[model samples]
Target chain A: MDKKSLTRRLGRPVLGTVAALAMTAGMLGTGPAKAAESFKIGVVTFLSGGAAESFGVPAWNGGKLLIEALNRGGEVPAPYDKKGFGGMTIEYVLVDEAGGATKQVQEFRNLVQREKVDAVLGYVSSGDCLAVPPVADELKAFLILYDCGTPRVFEEASYTYVFRTAAHAAMDNISLARYMKSKGIEAKYFAGINQDYAWGQDSWADFVASMSVIQPGAKVKTALFPKIFAGQYGTEISALMREKPDLVHSSLWGGDLQAFVLQAGARGLFKRAQVAFSAGDHVIPQLGNKMPDGIILGARGVNGLAAKARPNALTTWFWDAYTKEYKVFPVQAPFRMVQGLLGLKTAVEKAMVANGGKKPNAEELAAAMKGLEWDAPSGRIQMTLGGGHQAIQPNAIGRTKWDTAKGEMTLIDVEYYAAECVNPPDGTKAVDWIKAGFPGAKCK
Target chain B: MTLLRSVPAASALAFAALVLAGFVLPDWAMFLVTMAFAKGLVALGIVGLMRGGLVSFGQGLYFCIGAYVSGLMANWTGITDIFLLSLLGVLAAGAIGTIFGPLLANYRGIFFAMLSLSLSMILYGALSKMTTLGGTDGLNVAAPTFLGYAPEGRPLGLALYLYTSAIVVLVGGLMRGLFNSQRGLIALAIRDNELRIEYLGASVRTAMAINYVIAAVLGGLGGVISGLAIGHVDPEFSFWTTSGEFVFVAILSGYLSIPAVFVGSILLEVVRSFSNLYFPNTWQLALGIFLLLVIVLLPRGLGSLTLRRRKAKEQA
Candidate 1:
């Protein structure tokens, strides 16, 4: 076609399209500005891979429920009675934490820089928790580590913008040891088996340190550390059976814990020794009647089906909502996640009030969260450690009793420990505190 | 003349583009590209082994070694210089490779793959059990200083991207040269007919061992850069699945040009990031389907498309 005819043919349509595009852009741009401001939170947890079934899914579900309830208004008790954070609706962008630490760091940056999230909550792996804090601090973004149990995130490198809402690994082990002492479980020989990774190794070290203080003369017979997600426990169980220590301890969680219990139970290892598990509540619902009776265990805190007995209204609401939605009782993971969200809610609301009910910036949010206190499904979580960057919360420990008729594993002879009894005090390292026989600790 | 012939103009242009990317790309995209380049180097090492008729299911052993060595140096010795750390990482992996190369040279096919996997698993076990190295939680490498200058925040990321890009480009050029050298030809010849090469008075084992060592150094380089960029190293770096990822990327790139390996790695990362964001629960399924499509439609992988286009242009 000739140039003039071609230009004439295309000009009208091109002009029409440009006019439509400009109109659409104007229409779209105004819509978002008029709506109530949204407080964008990046929620990261394991949504796939091995951890998803036990920890990641439950934690993600908990975050989802909490955000939904908060957006709908007045789902939680007083102090959290207002909808959203200071009247701005809470919106979450979920990211998978299934990949290794490197990918997680990249995803975290994407959440902050690309998605423009104001704050981030969630990391189920200690490795991820350790890797992300520095980046978060550098970016000056508010980060709440919900479920990772590492104490090093705070103790090793202090960050102004990073906080862990759950108590560190030391608390779980110390509380369990305290429960054992309170119950008068006399044992001369102690044997422990834990996952070989950081979480497992740290838990075991804390347990041993606490045992030395609580049962000074007790000898450790054998210590086994199988790899994480190893699944097979035949050799380890056989080794434990051979030692036949008076007391056996393990910190295995998720599918690894389930596998170990089933294999050990079949081999009758539970009968030979009084066994104790830190972070054991995850497997109770999965094991049901299969869970051994009278084996001492703790759920990292006062979490899981065990917390259903707590008399708090918020606890009851969370338990009922989670159970009804998931068709299974919430475990330690969900409990930690809820605690994190609750703490975030309190911090945001406080910051909002300080800022005259407008959305708070990262600095204001961090300021508000420092030393914040709030009620959770587990109990009261207080920022009492790590210069107020770490949380200390009370936890319950008890022995398991399998009720065959009910097809459930129940916590019996349950005992609660105040946060001050277990967690390290501010400015003291956990290992150092335990080595010093928990100096200045007040157990009640 | 040989050096000039071996170096492709496209590689030089690509390197320049990557260096420029640091200034223009967003922080997250720059981080993603840096990682993809690092991982792509590991994939190139796997490709090197493939050309020698060898497939390692555990290049992650050397990769992990490089990362851990760099991390340990920073933690124990307080050496935060990236150049020195990179040198130490390469030397450490190369030393291990030299020690194990003789034993590995005797094995081929599935035996080589299994032995590689076994070696990596042993490292994984040891890393998991050693509490001082942070055990399974792994140790963090301090934010590396570039030439003794400490940069923080966006500057640190940009510095890392530039450093990583330069290393990848230099390595790629060296690899291309090796592909055309007498030693490289000898290695490929061994893959085709080891007996014939031996009959020609060439030492097959020595050639294979040399290639293996070279591959180890490349893997180590990739790991060190990655560890520095990410600021953490763990036993998962040596896990069998990690090695499998290298193999997967190598296969996806095909046994073709070095740049194809980088392209393949970048594509994989993009797919993973987007899928994880949009479909968290089904990302794995999404990756699986992508692999299925690639395998079915392009047996020689995405690399063949470039060759096909070139041939078509020549025909026209």
Candidate 2:
């Protein structure tokens, strides 16, 4: 084609397209966003990254199962069988939390501003859990952090619209320490290896501080903090072996946990020391026989085998339903997710009553959830910290035992601690509580 | 000088449009554009370096530095004004970028990219270890005041939006002027033939260094705007993947039209938000396919389309 014809062809079409786009923008500029009839909830979880399999997917699975069941009306157990959240049809908007904190901040805003979800209830990454609350409070969107273990979210700052339904990392390590002392496990000259992030550092600090109180005069040999998701543990394991600690503790999770176990197991680190993991139960099914026997561990709470050991009607229904759905026993992630959902259901229903049976707004939801207590599959959850924004729940610890006939790794000699025994009281920080020798703790 | 003669006037118009947009657009759209504008500034820096034949894989280093400077100042000294924070961010990132520019100018191609990558990774490591700064959890930036007025709700969102748009326009105008100036043409010459430029009595390293510093200033500006809008900053700001996104926008815009940088960034944010909303499980895949389609159709990126049409008109 001639140059003049080509110029006209390209320029005319491009100009037309630009004009069309501008028209669309003008149209969009005028319309105000409205909501749907269903009680929409934005569920954020890791659906596609390193944490997806061990934590995010299982948590997402639990959310889908419980939410769908609630919508089905009769599949759920009593008092909670009212169908969906206060008879409003439950519609979920699932978002992948695989991206980092900044991306999560953007996604959180998108969920609130664009999707118009009434409440958001997922964040496995502690970084995300910490980053999202301020935005949530600013936007006045209700947020329920289901799986992140950072105490800083509620401790460092208070939020009116944000709540976490699971106990923070302090509970996991505190319960671990108390369980060890109660079982009379020797812990002198202890060493720790944990991921270097907030979750890992907090877990290690609590364990050491609690050990100082319970097993007084014990010396800390060394604490190695490798970067999170750093698969290789050769150097850290060698360092631990050299220290020849009487006990070793780690709070690693996800692929990091599995990789650490396999690497450390090969070097017989568990045999050399009374090794313990603060949040290790989720790795049980994946590691199977690879996980060395007699390694002390906690699921971060009374979950999986701990919940099974003290079965209730809710526990039986949840465990069976989860296993029947996923073909594996529910672990810490799914259990934690279920408990959070159950708590939300109770809160939503309660808020509905107060809001004249309409789907309540964020303010009503926050009021309903504050200081709320409800029965969960694991046990009861109470919003008792951060002025009724943070949850404190019972947690358990145990030793790994391989069952030959069952062909699975199981927990034996499991011990569960009451909520008051592990979590810090209101207005007290986790680190301070541990360093203060865990005063006023009720350990029964 | 002729590359984009109309850019100065166009950027001013864009600034006016963006300021008007904040008043009419919904909160979500305003936020999306604000964020995109910030990111586009970072990409603009990458383009500045690209014109001097240097491709940095570590702009996130400056981004994180700027974010932390503004965030820490707010958290520590209680300086909550957006304008003051933006100035500090630009100064801090620019100073640091200046220190590394001459050293980096000594290298080229893959070596330059790798060294830049290492620089960002080091920042990531250092920030991750600093537990006092909230470690990997990072710190929250409170709502920044516009001049002394601390607005809340939609007004705060809109204020941040306007502030970001104004900064982008201001920088975009200055960059356009620089790109068409004598020094800018020297950098472009260095990109095409560094040895020839050196033989022609021009200091190639100096030109490269100048471009590097300019890029750093732009990156810092972006970081400040983002810290204000997102209300959080973490080590992830310096992560390699984050830098990769900035570089992607630079590549997608193709160091051609200055406005195309913002277009590319805004397009990416829009695509990401919509696809993630519709296809949560396969959004990354959807993004990959979209990128592939764009590259196939526009070989020199979206900017080249404008260049081609202009060339055809001149021939006619």
Q: Write down the C-alpha DockQ for each prediction.
A: 0.30, 0.51
Cα deviation at B106, candidate 2, in Å, is 1.3
Q: Judge candidate 1 at residue B224 and give its lDDT.
A: 91
Best by lDDT: 2
Candidate number of the best TM-score: 2
Model 2 off-target regions past 4 Å?
Answer: A1-37, B1-7
What TM-score does each of the candidates earn?
0.92, 0.95
In model 2 chain B, the worst 10-residue window by lDDT is B1-10
In angstroms, the error of model 2 at A110 is: 1.4
Model 2: how far is B185 from its true place, Å? 1.1
- Chain A TM-score for candidate 2 is 0.93
Task: Kindly list the per-residue Cα lDDT of model 1 for residues A1-444, writing each as its tens digit.
Answer: 986556444543543353345333322222123245888889999998889988999888887888888889987777677888777888877888987897899889878876778899989999999988888988999999999998898888889999999998898899878877888887799999998778777888898899999999788999998877899999999998898799998999889999999999999998899999988888877888888888898888889866876657888888888888889988889999989988998999889889888889899999999999988888889997889989999888888887778876778899988899898889999999999999988887
Model 1 interface root-mean-square deviation:
9.8
In candidate 1, the residue pairs with backbone N, CA or C atoms under 3 Å apart (3 or more residues apart, or in different chains) clash, namely: none
Q: Supply every candidate's count of residue pairs whose N, Cα or C atoms clash at under 3 angstroms.
A: 0, 0
